[model samples]
Target: MPSAISRFAKFAAIAALTSATVFASLDDAEARRAGSSGFGSRGTRTFQAPPVTSTAPAPAAPIERSMTPRPQTTAPATAQQPFGAQRPGLFGGFGRSMIGGLIAGGLLGMLLGHGFGGGFGFLGMLLQIALIGGAVMLAMRYFANRRQPSYGAGGQGGSFSRSNSMSPANNSSFQIPAIGSGAGSRASSRGNRPSDEIGLAQADLDQFEELLTDVQTAYGAEDYATLRRLTTPEAMSYLAEELGENATNGVRNRVSDVKLLQGDIAEAWREDGQEYATLAMRYSSIDAMVERDSGRVVSGDDRRPSESIEVWTFVRKSGADWKLAAIQGSEQRAA
Candidate 1:
């Protein structure tokens, strides 16, 4: 019933209205978001919207943090020591080494001292001094005099006889022809006879033994000063050197089996205004065990009871008692 041209116009107008409605809906959503942020004008078109924010939040400021110190950590199972303990220091190790070295040095010193002769190399000299010292002491005790001539055996001034069978002047077997003094006559006659004979008083023998005992005690005690006083200077020095060695090596000597077999004054003579007496003695002795710190021995038959001969010549100076001048020892001359 309607004209064709009117229908066409109506259809076009409907299409235009539909497009406008869709545009409006989209604009409403934008406006809602802007209003919440105060960016929208009053009375702007409003509509429901999906949840939204007007401006993206400023990207979170990059966090700035620092690492902090931590407590000691536990050691791994493979470690030998526990946690927090430290190793030994340089000085500690050095101290241990020094202690070990000192111990080794001391042991070596002792071995060298005892393993070799005379106690050891340096110690032998000391032992020699001790031996000489002990020997001299025994000599002093045993060989302090010589035998006096028997009354019936000689015409010496110190002899007296109580028998008529032997002539009172001189025994037939012990003749001393009177002679005028001459150098040749004295040399052939007096020199052949003993220079002189002297008797040993019991008191003299006792005193000699006492002095000798004192010397022996000193030697046993290693008192070198006493030994020097009782013996000659040369003898003292010899002994001192030996004692020094003994101190170094730690060895000592002892003499035993001393017997005063015979002792008497050999002669009372004057030479250069000095009086002297020659004494002869016989005895037996042996080297015995004394000390062995350095580990040595003087090997021989020390207790064999063999005799020895000793000759001790003495000199007396003004204001001084008799002192030993020289001494001689002989194993073959025993008796």
Candidate 2:
């Protein structure tokens, strides 16, 4: 039989081992090949789609999991017609009715012995048709010609003269502005704004790169303390949940040798007293999952490295160090 002191020693040893495992076990989010899905928050823009960059030209996959409420975005209706819609003809209902009425009245004049100005013979019928057609053609041409916008001597045209139109000229109620015209003044204003509004210094970019390595390192090691230091509360919570789920499944993930192959700024802005920047990065790493107890290979190869393109969002208060706010798998299917 074991002595009470010996049992106490063995139990203490087991507890220490258990504590060590707890610290090292939850590397799921960092160690596994994070799927081509996005999650977490990106400040006020969490639900908004990130802009496309050269490194990530294809549309990014929508964030699958997020703390921010997805905003309802209604697409603006277009002025263009749908495909294959037939336009109304020039000589439509009103024109046809006008021509028909002229013919009827001319024949009635003949029946009533008016004889189209007292001619009444075969030549009179032929004369009536020719006169009516010539009058109609002249009237239509004159009416159409009168609606033209007057031009200055310098050839610049003024606004069109107002008049009652049987049908709108060209059947258009509004003129579509040209591509380079001032129609998009509001959108162009944004494009014209200086990029310095975000004020990302070279130092800031360096910090972002440093954060990338630190975050992945802390995540792979299951170092919650480091993770908490490097990530926002909301992001840490999501990562913690992912690791817990993996731990519950009795698997441990490991990632190493992270290398940033390409990186570019996706977007940047300031709001709510915090500045945010989303960066698209292509990186490669050795990621694998193994059984927690026996350490048997369960998924992923430890010796082989895999590539992933992702958008990482970092947020910080004015003059504060940047912290990871979100990670989204980018549009890797284009590759």
Candidate 3:
């Protein structure tokens, strides 16, 4: 058999090599991630998928990553906490009295040298007490979790009246001087269309178009400041992570000729004083990745522009300009 010390050294070596390999794999994965992958916060609708639009006939991809905290669902309210909430205080009432009696009996046996606590002494008594207390706590916790209600298909926030949400008071419209606004282009009947509580105007749509160009160019140029200004903090963080990965891979993304072909509102809603709009857009651009130092194209055609269809969710609070909050790729090709 190999000596114990030699075996330990070999094990350590193997562990170190494995750790290095894992880290290298992670770095490569990050590099390939490029940018957001159907990720980012969309307020209460973070987990919900946006509706498909004419520009993007297919459904939007599910959000794979997000900063939005998952909403905590609770059981229906009753007289107490929830479904028969009778949480006893981990060995409370008569249980406490029984524990006290046991401790007293154990101490008495120890005084008589009758092998109290398995003949281990006071330390053993302490261990016994700890073990019992831990068990009681665990049992209480398990019951509590069992009683906790699981989220339904849509949760509380998911089910809302489309007619009520898209009422005249909440109707948002815009007029695009260039290609005509897509207002009233929505499906005649609202099935799962997200509703906006607050209405947005023509100027907001115009600005959204402007932001589309600005954000794309800024990301291509790796301009962190511009990106920060145009996107929400959470969205900016994801963009920065992508940029860092590109830098690590010694390459950079370049984009130009950003022209919006068509776009339509997928959903618009307001919550907690913030306005949100998810828009499906089709645009063309010359997007390429190139070596950082030499600026030689590595992935995309520099001259030939390609089309992309994506859903972008924008958010704004009070009187602030709309900022990009999320990005999702379309799921299916347009028929």
Candidate 4:
């Protein structure tokens, strides 16, 4: 009886230990999810910029969000007329000529007798009038065709104008270079030129790095005010929600040692008088979660650092400070 009781007690102890291990593992996984990068949402999930090489992989599916603003189209300027009015229409210039032709034809027919010959006089007068009227109509049509504007070969007539607006001359030839071929040279040339096209400078890149650190630090501290100022309203909402969930679970996410490893501009553009830039960044940090009351680690390695790659987009109005607009995970990370 004693031996049987001993075995039963040992079995119960083993089962209990196994169960505790499993639950702890689950808790750690959940904690990692709570503090993971790419937790917040912003902008459309679909990739909109031109493709570029990056350490991060492409997203398996497009994100769900509204698309960013696009450039505003300006209406074409109206061409000024020499006399400050529209040119005369076809009948406006030929009305008198047409009237004269009709009068002359009638007079000629009346002058001829009603039966000059054998009842053929009236028919001959009618024929002369018809021929005169047809000649006048043909002349009018010819002049109208001449006055019409002519479009050059290969020109489409809809919304696009035939004349090149960017060039000083009326016509210009623009060639787009193939991607990955002479791209560096083209980029250098564009950098040299003065245009409205968006391009990131060294200072702008530095600011991006700074923002990455600032955002993570502020998030770890649960600083809502700073987060609101640094991120867009949409992103702010998401971060707040995640932080709330952590609080409800009685855990606090802690992040530190945030370091940017590598980064490059995925794309940049100006739209609706605002500038936007998306950057692919590989960074490392120490992320962990601890119990609020006991300060016991619930998940993650507090001593070791982890590396993650993410794509972040920033937006700003002209002459304004840039703010975080969106964040996406690299191929291997889950949002």
RMSD (Å) per prediction: 57.5, 32.4, 14.6, 32.6
Q: List model 2 lDDT by residue over 1-335, tens digit each.
A: 33664454344434433433332322322223334356678877786667655545444555656778866546565556543333333323466455555555554564454534365554555565566656655554454344321211110011000011121112111111111233222333435211224856667777887887777767667789999999999889877876786688887666677666656666778888988887766656566676779988776656766555667889999878999998776544313
Model 3 C-alpha lDDT per residue in residues 1-335, reported as the tens digit of each score? 33664454344434433433343243235324433246689988897767655556555666667877876757564535644333544344565456545645554554454433466744565476456546644654555445333211111111110001110121222323222223333532545543444555677777878888899889878889999999988888877877887788888778787766666677778888888988776666677777899999876666776656677899989788899998876654322
* Model 1 lDDT per residue over 203-275, tens place: 5445454444454455545687777666555445544554565456545545454444444333345555555
Which candidate's TM-score is highest? 3
Would you list the clashing residue pairs of candidate 1?
118-124, 126-245, 126-246, 145-263, 145-264, 146-263, 146-264
Summed backbone clashes in each candidate are: 7, 0, 1, 1
Candidate 1, after superposition: displacement of residue 93 in Å?
65
Task: Quantify how close model 3 is to the true structure by its C-alpha RMSD in Å.
Answer: 14.6
What pairs collide in candidate 3? 196-269
Q: How far is candidate 4 from the true structure (C-alpha RMSD, Å)?
A: 32.6
Every model's TM-score: 0.35, 0.53, 0.58, 0.48
Candidate 2: stretches off by over 4 Å: 1-35, 72-196, 333-335
Candidate 3 segments whose C-alpha is farther than 4 A from its true place? 1-36, 72-190, 194-196, 333-335
Q: Give the clashing residue pairs of candidate 4, or none.
A: 45-63
Which pairs clash in the backbone of model 2? none
Per-candidate local distance difference test = 0.35, 0.57, 0.61, 0.52
Worst 10 residues of 3 by lDDT: 158-167
